[model samples]
Target: MTKVLPSLLASDFTRLGHDIEKMEAAGADIFHLDIMDGQFVPNISYGMPVVEAISRTASIPLDVHLMTLDPEQFIDALAALGIDMVSFHIEATNHPHRLMQRIQQSGMKAGIALNPHTPVAHIQHLLAEIDFILIMTVNPGFGGQKFIDTCVDKVRTLDALRAEKGYGYEIEVDGGINQETAEICREAGADLFVSGSHLFKSEDWQEAVREMKQ
Candidate 1:
């Protein structure tokens, strides 16, 4: 089954608690958090405080996507806060192998994210060291961006890598993932789907998840 993770990047932060509650009731498997620092990405998003709030209210695991430079600086802090997964951009750090080790040592699921321009070979050496790989289908700054069609090809390439290595890593596709794109990713071997705008705009959020599950 494909897992549905609702991104909080597009949620109304003023009423974020309520938004998270609604998503939980709607059967979201994980709460996807997009953390950005203006330098790495184009925009600055919530920091540890906001993530703490989500961690408190979220019944499901927090799938934190760190789109900042020096993700290693904050890994310990986030891990101490008890998030389930912490994903960092492969290009953001100098030592991804050591960083993955630290994350695992801290008892959190370690993940690596790939940008639109990054290739699957960048993570080939560390494939077995990760729990999952997040493929960005859109540019990483904000929400509601158009899906980059070429991402489907990237997803398939990563899927092939995982299969060849017999690694346990899951392929998670973020950005512009709606019902139609979800099918595309799944067919390309994606196991997790991250949706923000489509989820919030849905009339019946839980039913929306059910449809994605199909």
Candidate 2:
């Protein structure tokens, strides 16, 4: 089954606790947190404090996506907060292997994220060392962008590579993932779906999440 992870980036910050309660009740498998630094991505998003706040009330696992330069600088801190999974952009760190090891040693699942413009081959060497792979369907930084069509091919490529190598990493697709686009990704072998605006903006979030999972 494809796991649906609602991006807290697009959630109602005012009613965060209530929103999380509703999403959890709706069967959300994980909570996706987009952590951005203005230097790496054009926009800056919430940081540790916000994540800590979310962790206080979130019952599900926290899947933190770091869209910042030098992601290694924050791995220990995030892990200390009991984050379940930490994914950093492959382009963000100079020491991918070391960073992955640190995350694992810190007791958190490590993942690598690829931007829409990045090729799948870039991280193929480290696939065996990671737990999950996040493919950005839209450029990182902000939410509510249209899905980039070519990203689907990237997902297919990663899925094919995983099959060929027999790697255990899960394929996660983020950005512009709604019911229709999510079906496309799911068909292409993506197992995790990160829905932001489409989910939070829905009149019936429960039905929306259910449709995405279906």
Cα RMSD to the true fold for all candidates = 0.9, 0.8
> Roughly what TM-score does model 1 have, to 2 decimal places?
0.97
Model 1 CA lDDT for position 207 = 94
Task: Quote the RMSD, in angstroms, for model 1.
Answer: 0.9
> In candidate 1, how many clashes are counted?
0
List, residue by residue over 59-165, the lDDT tens digit for candidate 1. 89889999999999998889888998989999899999999999989999999999999988898899887898999999999899999999899889888877887
Reference-based lDDT, each prediction: 0.92, 0.92
Error of 2 at 208 (Å): 0.7
> Which structure among the candidates has the greatest TM-score?
2
Clashing pairs in 1: none
lDDT of 2 by residue, 47-151 (tens): 899999999999999999999999988987898889999999888888999999999999999999999999988997898879999999999988999999999
Q: Which stretches of candidate 2 lie over 4 Å from their true place?
A: none
Each model's total of backbone clashes: 0, 0
Question: Local error of candidate 2 at 33, Å?
Answer: 0.3
lDDT of 1: 0.92
Q: Global CA lDDT of candidate 2, please?
A: 0.92
